[model samples]
Target: MIGYVTIGTNDIEKSKAFWCDLLEELGASVVMDAGRIAFIGNGSEKAMLAVCTPYDENAPHPGNGAMVAIDPGSKEMVEKLYARALELGATSDGEPGQRIPDMFYGAYFKDPDGNKACFYQFA
Candidate 1:
């Protein structure tokens, strides 16, 4: 199973701020802050998302074909989180809607740092 996912960021503070604000609505907060890295989620025991500067010190770049998908629990919350991501400076990759009739409803976007994510729900 997955414990967490770390997205590389050139601007640690900016990335942390963006994620903190966006995930706050889901009761997730900064569970740990170790200077260049910050983990956000409900608790350390649960899966969390980490925004950090690359350890090798190279400029952070989004990896092609990699994405983080979050299940917000309902179609409405998927819509809400998608919109919130945009409001927080994410660029739309896909709009909110069903991807497979009644089976999946999702939205996609790239964060300010260009990390792709999906907010989705399954019926």
Candidate 2:
């Protein structure tokens, strides 16, 4: 019962480049673009990820304790994407590893705009 998740950015173009390049690994592309806002994903049937400028026109900031979690289908993918995010200028929040005993493997990072995200897989 989930639709899409929106992340605020002060630099829409930079965020777009970062997200589009990173998400392309999963075959997600810019399905919609409205100048100040853009949506990236496979299609409407799957949850989409959107990056947008704040409607209020003030500087955008990441919300405390909010995060977007993505399942990239495997532990290897998590590791690969986590490293890729860092290479794309994301700062590390957590390294790729099993978060729960033989159950959840994940990696975490904060995008250039400070939006938190996770890539994970269930083992």
Candidate 3:
């Protein structure tokens, strides 16, 4: 029941670089680039990720505990995405591993803007 998510950004270009490079690997691309750019997943325009400077013109601040949970499609994909995020300068919130054995497998990290995020698979 989710359509899209918008992450606040103070520097649009920096945030654009982050999301573009990252989401493009997951099959999304820049579909909207007006005031706020949004990356829409291939074959689904309804679900998108966007970055925008606050309308009030204040510095963008990441909300604590808010995250965009991603599904990279497999355990291997999860591992790869987690590692790639770190390589691109994202801080680790938690390393790649099982959060609950035989149940929930998860990995966590903070994006460049310090937004908490994760990808997981059912084990």
Best by lDDT: 2
Over 4 Å off, model 3: none
Q: Model 2 lDDT vs. the true structure?
A: 0.94
lDDT at 66, model 2: 98
Q: List clashing residue pairs in candidate 1.
A: none
Q: Determine which window of 10 residues in candidate 2 has minimal summed lDDT.
A: 37-46
Residues 15-112 of candidate 1: C-alpha lDDT, one tens digit per residue: 98999998888999899999989999999899999999999999999999999999988888999989999999999999999999879888999999
C-alpha RMSD values across all candidates: 0.7, 0.7, 1.6
**Model 1 TM-score relative to the real fold:** 0.97
For model 2, how does the per-residue alpha-carbon lDDT over 1-123 read when each residue is reduced to its tens digit? 888999999899999899988989999988889999999999878899999999999999898999999999988899999999999999999999989999999999999999999999999
In candidate 2, which residue pairs get closer than 3 Å at backbone N, Cα or C atoms, i.e. clash?
none
Expressed as tens digits, the lDDT of each residue in 1-123 for candidate 3 is: 777888887677787777777766787777777765545455444677778888788887888778888888889989998888888878999888988989888889887887788888887
**Local accuracy by lDDT, each model:** 0.93, 0.94, 0.79
In model 1, which regions exceed 4 Å deviation?
Answer: none
TM-scores, in order shown? 0.97, 0.97, 0.89
